[model samples]
Target: MPLLFLNEKSWGTACDPARAERAMADFVDAVRAAAAADGPGTALVSEVDVKALEIAEGYPVNKWIGVSPRHRVLWQRLRGLQGRSPVRSVFPTENAADHLEYRHDGEVVLGLGAAHFMDGIAVSLPVARQWQADSVALERGELVEDDDGTLDMRHDTVVVRHLSAEPHLDGHLEWIRKTRSEGVTTGPRIWDSRADLYPHLTFLPRVEGQLGSLNPHWVLSVRRALERLEEAVAAWDPATMAEPEWRTKVSPEGETRKRVCRFTDLDGETRTFDLHARFTPGAGRIHFRLVPEEHTIRLAHIGGKIRPDL
Candidate 1:
């Protein structure tokens, strides 16, 4: 299931206490409705965010919750979630390093940071510009304005904004509904079909072309392998990533290891892409290169497995 983190930065004072309470009620309702349509997902929260929820706009939000018996019960359930933790508790262990460092303003943004680290969605109120935008940008470890007055990142973290607005709520529901129907659409980015695979996979341009011509029969197998690879890449340290044996035959090229295992990248530099996985016996193969220092995978080829004897 998807993991949604509460955007702590979205909490702030408002001029109209009633309006603020209404907005909070709407946001909570939207979350519950989405969960009902899809299966319930883990909602990550921090002590800071929960306390902020208790008091915002010069009024206690819990009082608003008490006004509605339904809301009071729903709020209690959300408060009992196991994801509630102290600030910065979401950080991974010291050994498993990654390139995507979480950053915000000078102050800590615990929820967004945790969402990014965990490859989950950051659920925010329509308050700050960073949370308001469909996408957000970061520069030199800080959230910065974008060229088009928006925010973005390639292979970016997903941020669902403005739960109270119908348009934005519709967008969030689209994701949830799709996730329920199609399994891969759960994370920050939606991978509803083969067309939606590129952004999440991040394959090299030439390798992408190879995917187009692949046999139709092996397509599902390939998708499964890539999905597993995506999960592994997110969870494991790159240096030791190959330790696990994958069901889809993730391993180095065997007989042709010396010959076709090396390929030139877009930069015209010869690089070894020995890591490979088979779609099936003698059917199709996916060979890729891993950049450990950057924690990235550059898919070099996706075609028939090379065989020296053949």
Candidate 2:
């Protein structure tokens, strides 16, 4: 699950108490929904103690939760193991990453539990620019991307304003899927690799035969390249969507590109699997044909570099 950090900086002072209470209510509801969607205790509040914070001009967030009738019930379910626990303070035990900040395009964003956005956590927008809290004002419906390119330029980070949004959920699920793909080396025999590991892939029989002949050292690379294809196909319809060059690239063009890129499909007809991902520049490759009609990628070859001059 993607980490949802408590945007403590979001709790600005000097606002109307009633409106702040309502906004905090909404934030609580959003957190509840996020926790419900991702699992219990998925939302983190703050390490500095929420008691000192106010949602509105007069109402402290902790006080509001205790006094508000609706929040009283919901907080009970999400508090976890203890009545004193208002919000999760520590990162989940399942998360192994040792870091909390990630740097992108020179601007540093805090509270990302891991290195990459795909596997790390999300911090609310307007996050302390340059480590100075209160530097950026938190506003509802504000696109931090416009301010710092946090959402627009990066794949990670979610805003508390809209916890149920598609992009946030998709990113979290993508992390889970990626984690599930991590242990490719311990998978079944080469013959079963296709069915066991590459469920999203439609392997040509010849490609399966080639799998057995591939260097064991190179198998991990093949798994990674194919995983990229699987992620692309699962995320969008290739027929209507543009190719994700970031994940898989057009097989390089050269004289050997024509002969090496063509392969026999399961139908016994020769077809071009022009889209390819390289595991190694000149040593390993995954040649694949995208079947837009079926919305899947068929692996034509899974070993050795195929180039223009070959």
Candidate 3:
């Protein structure tokens, strides 16, 4: 005999008292029909317990049952498992199985638990097992890439990118998406390698200028590049800060085009800090002075790259 386990939660909350009673009656009729169709020799098992009813009372009854007569009949027959202790009913043996389960979603409508035997196309345990396996694989980021080579970042990928305790990480990602969507092409790019540092920096629309005002579009690009620099600082890795692609170098004098602007450290010794720059197309240059510490990099100055002599 096959066992049908009704989800007590679904049964108790989905229908009102009157509807529940009617659903139960319809369920009995359906079981009887199923048994009759299977012939006289087959036996079916229907079991329900009191615990399910207790839990079902706390849930809202599924009102969709009343809207469709077919749904009401089917749901009642499938999930209507309310009764006293060890409620058992018998119908026909053709519905018998080694295992039984119901699906709230996806293909395999009803699953039967049992090994292969001398019977015609009986539902078996592996059907349900395979469904569960496929679901797990999908959840684990085993996504098939479309022809365009795009795939959603999985939960694990998001976790890895979430490096800071800052709350506006999603906002940064949204800004990047928006910038790309607008087709604004200005960059000596900064986020290529140090994306992990974006959350720690503030992206101002424009920085103070000494020469002439910076272009708004160019400022936006500079802001993004500086954000990448700030991210590298927050990561506190020298290799990341010193990467050749980041354009880290000594500030240069305009007349001589030579490095200058040396700083004196706390030890009374003069030390030169590397300045980072990103050349904006037709918009001159933007420069940054990095003030390094044990754990952070402070932005000493940010503005248009003016001549050191000036």
Residue 170 Cα positional deviation in candidate 3, in Å, after optimal superposition: 12
**lDDT digits (tens) for residues 28-81 of candidate 1:** 665555445456555555546464464356566667676778768767765654
TM-score of 3: 0.27
Against the reference, the lDDT scores of all candidates come to 0.54, 0.49, 0.33
Question: For this target, which candidate reaches the highest lDDT against the unseen true structure?
Answer: 1
Model 1: residues with Cα > 4 Å off, grouped in runs: 47-57, 63-74, 77-83, 86-100, 104-107, 127-166, 173-310
Check candidate 1 and list the clashing pairs: none
Please give the distance, in angstroms, between residue 99's alpha carbon in candidate 1 and its true position after superposition.
5.6
- Tens-digit lDDT string for candidate 3 (1-310): 2222222222444334455544444434534443333333323221333223321243323544454687567555534432222212321133322122222233222212111111111111111223111011111121222212354322221011110112212323443344334432223233222233344443222232321344433434455456555555566555455532342222333434325434444456554433445433222343434444343443323444444563
lDDT of 2 by residue, 96-136 (tens): 12222334333443333221222233333221232122112
Sliding window of 10 residues with minimal summed lDDT for model 3: 156-165
Instruction: List the lowest-lDDT window of 10 residues for candidate 1.
Output: 139-148
User: Model 1 Cα displacement at 206 (Å)?
Assistant: 22
lDDT of 3 at 19: 50
- Candidate 2, residue 204: lDDT: 81
